[model samples]
Target: MTAGPRRRGPARTVLVALPLAVFATVGVLAPILAPADPTANDLAASLLPPSAEHLLGTDQLGRDQLSRIIHGARISLAVTAAVLAISVTVGVVAGTTAGYAGGFVDRIVSRVIDMAVSLPGMLVALAVIGVRGPGVENLVIAMSLWAWAPYARIARARVTGLRASPHLDALRLLGAGPVRIICRHLLPPALAPCLVYASTDVGAIVLGVATLSFLGLGIPPPQAEWGQMLVEGRPHLASAWWLAYPPGLAITAVVFASNLLGERLAVGDERPSILRWVLPGRLRVRGGRALAARVTGVPATIATTSAGDGTLLRVRNLSVAYPRGSEHRRVVADVSYDVPRGKILAIVGESGSGKTTSALASFGLLDPSAVVTGSAMWEAGAAARQLVGLTPRERRQINGRRVGVVFQDSLAALNPLRSVGAHVDEAVRNAGNPGQRTAIRRVSEDLLHLAGLPDPATVTRQFPHQLSGGMRQRVQIAIAIAGEPELLVADEPTSALDVTVQARLLDLLARLRDELGMAMIIVSHDLAVVTRLADNVAVMYAGRIVESGPLDAVIGNPDHPYTRGLLDAVPRPGTVPGTRFRTMPGRTGAGPDDTTGCAFAPRCPDVVPECAHQQPRLLALTSLPAHRSACPRQQSDGPALAAETARDPDGV
Candidate 1:
């Protein structure tokens, strides 16, 4: 399951991290470590320059330069720490809130951040410091006040991007609240960059503080600070070179240390692989373990499970719409469905039929601009639950364990840079299982086999870009089924494959259902494909289910005219030459001002005057139980009149 080159503890990391850690620790103990009192004056040593008694000679005030520089370490570290703490805290909170709260809130927050950024930070800090006198607390406050706005802006931008990210959206649909979604899924990824920014800022901030103090507007006199010493020694540069050089060198060293540490930490984390041994054994082993966990199970969603129900997943009256210049255009309307433990209920539809939107809304996948006013329920297997109104963490509990998805596009789904095995392993850990190297590889191989891929070992080692389209789809299937999920929602899994490959994939799906008893929901425009695979069928048009029922009954005796038209349009081979095929009249389009009776009325062949005056309700026709049609004239039209109904297109 290992991917590419493994991450190792670089020589540079140790070189930087160790020294900075040592420096910071020593700075904390500076008051005790200095040989002479940092503030005490000696008249004899004053203006005497460097000597055995005074390693760095004395300042104009007769203070030992060496002692003062050592003591100054305490102030520098404190200011750096204070600025980091204040700015990071303020930035993370404000950025995430504004990012998640899109539209007017986002606009307003972004504008304020922009305004702050446009102003010169040093100038602002100077103004604030001018009002407040020179002191440790005042210096820290001044730097932080100017520094925090940038952090906030960065955090907000990340949150804005992550709020719409697939992972966060998945958590949201699982009933996660805004706070949990931001904190768990959104925050961790954002923190890596934030940390790097904070580290780099420390050097600039320390310099700023020093610059202020040197100007006599920083720490007060007699404080034994480096900046104050620099100011006092300026007049004696020709007579005494030792006093100024020592403190300047110390400042330069600390700044360099800060830069080095920040760069090492910036590397953050990388996926584990066989090559990771290039790193120290401990990190390599840990990474291997983590990769193993990912391949074996579902990735843990940042959702909670305390709100009980084995409800697993649910959606009720979920409607979504896009805003035009002045009006809202509906995309998903009054859609609802639920999946219990170990069952798959397919939502079938064509492009723009709202199949994807319905799926997304079930897990909160829409943009924040889209208005959502429905409850999605979630119940872990054998656990009672409410999917809607539950926090994002709660919903996350079911994402990998109970619900997994396989999209139509496989290549776009998996990461291009990662190997198939490592990709699978990532999911295993995300599900919170034990991550061991051997275990992950074994699980990854098993998943490949389960997906009906040949030569599991060879395939697992290959990157996504190296695989064929069908093979990529198999990998996607492996990922979706990695957690041994209770429900698998496959959106046109075989659509992209040729007929031969499609048949094989369908067989694999059927086997999974028979062997695992996992529930399935497959959306497709191919009725013949659905007829063979699905136990029940749903026909969707214009963002609504026009008809739905058991597969046989729906195909044999479709109650909806739309379904009949679709069946008439299916290509049948071996027909005579020059024969014209049946085609559904009118193109699919949604006008902003459209307020017609039925959405499909413009396209329906059996459109009557009444059909254009009122919307149809889903009602039972004189058909088998569980079969329903959303049409005004169903049972009223007898079977003898079926031939005249909609003219059956042109020819069979």
Candidate 2:
């Protein structure tokens, strides 16, 4: 179920670059394109206006203005190219090294760049020309001397900001050398902003060259430069306007085009709606109501049935698609599962398997770009609420109050600036807890204590950064449970943590579940982690629930090949040292909409010819009524998934 056509780059970018491209082309082909020799003098043909032979007319020196302007473009392009080449290379290399090295090197480079930027660039060029004597080489060198500073500044800032990122640490752990890390990872990203800046610098460099030539400090006389032509035609403005205007207009077009191209590149996808006129529907969000109306593609009259007896949250035929260009691409499809009361249901899968996506979609936690469809029945007494299409106000009533979510990255999840107490206090207040400031703080500490944090009173006062990764995660859990939520949804809660921390967190979750009787949906990639707490396990592959049943039953005897592969990948208690982990044999990035048939067919060990041609249906096994497998070959006497859809006539 894909939507509109694939999107392309911004239309305004093309419009902006058109003039620049034309100028570049003229510069490159000036010799062939010019009608006559620009420097060849003929006083008889001089002062000629628009005519059959001379399109842009001639100068006072009898030089063809068109040819002169074209040749002038060649000169301007040369200067710009030289300056950018030298400036970008020098600036980026120096700045990247300084930022990566940091300390004294960073301070020295930063101070030097500041000094260069502070000086007037035009004045620096003029001074250089005065000292070194004027020429094309001198002009490029002068401009580049001052021009390199801004790029250095941009690159330095970009690289400095990335120094503390976790990915760099990951690279170090992977044994990547400094040279490999900097060249392969750091330089590319640092260069992007520098290049964008250079797009803008094109105009300045071209203008500077013309300015110098105008003052007789640029290209020598008789070189047919735009500024030289303008100065020569100054006395003949009323008589031969063609001489000045042609070059003047060319310079204006180049400057305008370069500046515009730079802005568009910097803005990227956030550019204004210039293309909406050309391509109707804009294909973005047509309207909030319009997009919302089409979200589920189901009639509003069709309501969800009550959840099963012991089910806290029952999701059926859940699907989520994100907007790809104008079209929608489905990630999760027909994912069905249940979270029984007071029990942990772990959704297990490799990366991109849509395990987290399906869980997030069930609670309306997916971003606005997501188009979700399905029936997620959240049981409340005798009645049930459909979580799929709930309005913001309605979802808010349930999500933060009834369901608490803990994301994997605690640093990202918690505001670094705020104290842990502030975070939990806000959550308590948001959950409609009415209390004085003191009472709120006390309750916040109590929530932290309940989450198993040590010395909640002291922990509450510390910021997220001051705490350990495990502590920060517990803080998130504290905030989540501050609302006294019935269902806790944790996405990769123990990922990237030490074994001790992971086990402790898992134990805490299990304790909370057993003591408080909390129904939980835990999303994890490791089946070993799931084994610790999960009563039921749903194995996802390519956005579909390939197999799901009681954790013991499914883990002991996996019905689907994908499920078997996942279980096999789990680290066993006693394996030979240095033995490679047994992993599934195919790429895992395909979505449900990528193919018509089973997405895992290329990787499936028991793949039959039919697996490539037909969409497999999830069927129950004759051995277990509660269990189901998407693979049709599995021994089972069960009804078709179509039957389940048929039962819910107008459902997901």
* Regions more than 4 Å wrong, model 1: 1-68, 95-130, 153-199, 221-223, 254-347, 352-485, 493-508, 540-581, 587-652
Candidate 2 matches the true fold with a TM-score of 0.53
lDDT of 1 by residue, 458-514 (tens): 987788889988888888888877766766888788877899988888888887776
Q: Compute the lDDT of residue 382 as modeled in candidate 1.
A: 54
lDDT of 1 at 250: 70
Name the candidate that leads on lDDT.
2
| Residue 26 local lDDT, model 2 | 90
Q: TM-score for every candidate vs. truth?
A: 0.63, 0.53
Taking the tens digit of each residue's C-alpha lDDT, what string does model 2 give over 102-136?
99999999999999999999999999999999898
